[model samples]
Every structure is written in C-alpha cells, then in structure tokens.
Target: MDKRLIVVLVVFLFVLWYALRTAQIPPASIQASAEVFYINNETVTIVEKDGWGLFTLEVKPRISGFTFEIEFPEGTEYLIKVNGKEYRGNTTFKTTIDKDSEIYINFRLPDEDTKKLYRGEGQYYLTIKASKLPIWYVEYKIKLIPRKEKD
Candidate 1:
C-alpha cells in the first residue's frame, strides 16, 4: 500500500468521525417545541415537525405592556391561547399564511386586577395551535419585585 494513500484514508476517517460526533439528532416525536423567556427583548425559533423549517417569535416588554409577534411559515394557520383562555375577543384567533403570518398581541401588566390575580408572582401558560399540526404549549413564570423608592 502507498504511504500517501494510507495517510489520506486516515484523514478521511477522522473527518467522518468528527462529523458524526457533532451532529445533532432531533427527537423522534412528530411534534417539536421550544421556548424563550426574557424581560425586555428576545427572539425564539419554533421548529416544525418532520424537519420542516422554523419560525420566529419576537417578544418585547415595555413599561406599560408586553408585545408578542410570531412569524410563521407559508401556508400555515395558527391559534393562540393564554393561561387556558382564548386570547382577546375571538373564540379562536386565527391567521393564514397567504397574508402575514405575523400575529401580534399586546397586554398591559401590573394593573390592580392583574396584581391581585397574579399575587406578585405566578405561572402563565401559552398555547399555540396550528390549524393542521399538533398543539404546542409553553409555560412561563413571572416574578414581581418591589422597587425601592428614590430618597
């Protein structure tokens, strides 16, 4: 056997081993889920099942309200629920792909009612239901800290 050929074969084997070792294998379930929680600004990628592409969810927190926006793939429709209740007025908030897949929701926080309901800190649940795909749900906890009064 040629010395150069043996060296080439050894290098190829190492590369193959490295590639396999670093590769990430997704879960086997038909549904996949991811979550991101932030106080101010953040972007989260929602991966679809069966190796489909991902979508982005952008969250922005402001002094008065919190904003949520979702950018989904084409030809997809979705419904959102907050804390086991449907968001806003609609029975089911729906959005289609042909139009903008980005859906936005804004909520005012720390109000008297909200403070009483949350009791300073509590867990909140969010559910995203694709019209065709399986249901996906995420849970987040919020803590309210009292700020010291300026002297």
Candidate 2:
C-alpha cells in the first residue's frame, strides 16, 4: 500500500475509535429504583401514581440554582422541603402541569465572611410530599465554578 494511503487509513481509524468511545452512555450514578429513573450523571426523574393520577418529579443542578420541575394531577397539592426546612416562600411558584412547572431555588457562593457558615459547594437534599402520592426524595450534588472576570 502507498505510504500516504496507509497514513490516512490509520488516522481515520483513530478518529472513529475516539468517537465511539466518547459516544457511549455514561454509567448511572444511582440505580433505577421502583419509582426513580436515573437519566444521567446529573438528572433524575421520579414517577409515582395514586388515586389522583400520575406524578413526576425532575431534579437538576444549574450554575446558580437548582431546577425543580414537577408534574402532578390537577387540583393535587404538594409541599417541598429543602434540607429539612419547609420551602414555602416566594422562591416557589405554582403552574399548570401541561406547562413547564419549574421552581428555581437560587443560591449564592458564600462570601469570605460567611464562608464558614454557608460553604457553597456540596450536596443538598430535597423531600417532596404530594397528596395521595408516595413521598419523593432526591439528593442534588452541586459544584460551584468561579465566573471568569472580563477585562
């Protein structure tokens, strides 16, 4: 075989191998349970059913806050608890299930003075209690990346 042809073939094979290796699905950090579906390394959705109907809970971490999206049967009631405290404040919002019913909980990096008290990066737990549905719970891992300062 010609030298140039051989070189091109080898390069093409390496590229193909790299693509296949990286395209593989990431192993689930949390195994699938009775009601929880581990979507990926950073997302999980919980599905439960009761007399009221089907309900779903999706949890994902964002740069500054955590996105808590949920879908419950109409007229159903639910409560959210963050780190053991009831989250019944302005940060929570109510919307229809057909729409993107998302509740964003904003958090900030602890400043130098308050770093010891509220060290920003770590895992946070959330417990959601829904009417006529099994209690849904999840732990969200958060990592804070510093923003680049623009000149």
**Top-TM-score structure, candidate number:** 1
Angstrom error at residue 131, model 2: 25
Across residues 1-151, which tens digit of lDDT does each residue of candidate 2 receive?
6999999999999998777654522111222222333334543332111211112333232112222333322222445433333443222233222222233333222233123223333322223322111222233332222222359
Q: Candidate 2 versus the native: TM-score?
A: 0.23
- Candidate 2: regions farther than 4 A off: 1-34, 37-62, 87-151
- The model with the greatest lDDT is 1
TM-score, cand. 1? 0.26
The lowest-lDDT stretch of 10 consecutive residues in candidate 1 is 59-68
Error of 1 at 9 (Å): 44
Over the stretch 6-30, how does candidate 1's per-residue lDDT look in tens digits? 9999999999887766553321111
> What lDDT score is found at residue 104 in candidate 1?
37
For model 1 the local lDDT of residue 30 reads 15
TM-scores for every predicted model: 0.26, 0.23
Error of 1 at 110 (Å): 9.7
**Which 10-residue window in model 2 sums to the lowest lDDT?**
46-55
In terms of lDDT, model 1 sits at: 0.33
